[model samples]
Target: MKKHIIPTIAFALFTTSAYGQSMQVGFSNVTTVVPGGDIKICKARYGTGYVTSPHKNGAKIHKSSDKGHFIHITKSNVTLHHDVYVMANEYNMSYPGDKGEITAKAYVYATALDRKSGFSGVFSDGQCKGQLTISAK
Candidate 1:
């Protein structure tokens, strides 16, 4: 009994410490230019897995008459060796029958950290964002 108890306790301690230090955290965002586009966003959190409802933390669309339109997404507490994807779309329209020929753009910002290092960056336009084929005259 004594021998079994000692081994069990040691195993528990080892696992606890290993998991405590093995997690990495990260954030990334990707945007697409439209009429129509596809956006893929990936974020990683080491050691500890992503929290439930990652997007619940913060995700939204912003529109302005002068600034146009944009989408903002944020995730927190992600798991290690795991990738999370987010999809979002945004658009705007001007006066009716005005032939809205305006150009659309997207932007993304993220912050992440790992057991070894940290990653924080921003992407815009044709950088990290993907452009969709828009049919217009």
Candidate 2:
């Protein structure tokens, strides 16, 4: 009885450890536009984003459902406020030479994410330049 109990306990512990908790994140009411008049959606379309040093207090902003995603700050290469934290995810844009609207792009899972002091993400031109306007849906 003792031997059987120990084996079962050990197996349960091992299984629980192996299948650890996974992170959950969501980005709704998302909208972004480019200087040329294009939209940028940072949902599952591209992938997860990065939350820079300003937009966070520690390594990451775990509770994002409360504070909205700061898409503008992540694109301007400048701090939104004194300390603008954010998610460093990917997005898509429609560059029709200032004659386009925002639309859902695609989704992807990235390997890692990075934090920065300025804008660095998906854009219409892919250069991180131009007006990458972003707001809640």
Q: Rate the local accuracy (lDDT) of all candidates.
A: 0.26, 0.26
Question: In model 1, where do residues sit more than 4 Å from their true spots?
Answer: 1-60, 63-102, 107-109, 114-119, 127-137
Q: Residue 20's C-alpha lDDT in candidate 1?
A: 19
lDDT of 2 by residue, 1-137 (tens): 11112232242232221012122332333444444433342332323332212224331212121223222111211111233322223333332232334333322222112121122233332322222212211
**Model 2 bad stretches (over 4 Å):** 1-20, 33-37, 40-137
**Each prediction's TM-score against the native?**
0.20, 0.18
Model 1 quality (TM-score): 0.20
